[model samples]
Target: MRERVGVYPGTFDPVTNGHLDVIQRAARLLDRLAVGVAINAGKGPVFPLEERVELVRAETAPIAAATGCAISVVPFEGLLVTFAREQGAEMIVRGLRAVSDFDYEYQMAGMNHRLDPGVETVFLTASETNQFISSRFVKEIARLGGDISSFVPQLTLERTLARVRDQAGE
Candidate 1:
């Protein structure tokens, strides 16, 4: 049997619980899952690409072990489909948080399909409890000194708080 590989690409500025939820679910379905940490400069991430990758790698370590799935965290640049192709992933895993996310993801999936017919896009809806968590919101909460412990894992929570404090000179 051919090994099933999938890529879950995201700009995990600070890996959130919601992202981990998607990763956990996706990991169980694929033999090898590549957690693609995208370097999206336009978003002006609080954590650098390397830090983001490290945080994600740390948070996902447990999930990989528990699920017995091979998970690799790789920093990526350029088109997502191109990255997936390079990783030899047959599918792209997407996590949909709400209806708002659908419109954007639908277009992206269609375009990716057009770009490469072989790689399929699969959407996984966020777990009910995590549906409302977004990195943008989590950052806002952290910047305002609000508790974000539930939104992110311990490693991300600590790093994000430290980064926000450092940036604010607090």
Candidate 2:
């Protein structure tokens, strides 16, 4: 049987808990999961591509080991559908936190389908505890010296705060 590989692509500026929740849930449904770190120059991410990739790898390691899922963190640029096809991903995993997210995701899903009819898009609703958590809000809170430990992993929170501090010349 062919291996079921899925790609979960995101900027993952600091790898929030909500992102990890989706990763963990998706890992169980697929034989392999590749967390694709998007290298979008336009997004102007606070964390560099490599840092984002490393953070995701570190955070997902335990879950990957526990689930026996071949989870890999990779950096990609350009079209997501193209990346998915190159990685041999049969599906693209997306997380929907609420009805607000569905409209945008639904449009993207349709575009991705048009790009590659063979690949499917799967949406996983965010867990109740993490439903409102987002990387943008987490970063904003951290930059303002608010505790973001609850929104992101401990390691990620530390790294984000340290980076923010460094940027501020602290």
Which candidate leads in lDDT?
1
Residue pairs in clash, model 2: none
Give per-residue CA lDDT, model 1, range 1-170, as digits (tens).
Answer: 99999999999978899999999999899999999999889999999998999889999999999998899999999999999999999999999999999999999999999999999999999999999999999999999999999999998898999999999995
- What TM-score would each prediction reach against the true structure? 0.98, 0.98
User: Where does candidate 1 have its weakest 10-residue lDDT segment?
Assistant: 153-162
Deviation of model 1 at 46, angstroms: 0.2
lDDT of each: 0.95, 0.94
Clashing pairs in 1: none
RMSD of each: 0.8, 0.9
Q: Once model 1 is optimally superposed onto the true structure by TM-score, how far is the C-alpha of residue 121 displaced, in angstroms?
A: 0.4
The alpha-carbon deviation from the true structure for residue 136 of candidate 2, after best TM-score superposition, in angstroms, is 0.4
Question: Can you give the lDDT of residue 115 in candidate 1?
Answer: 96
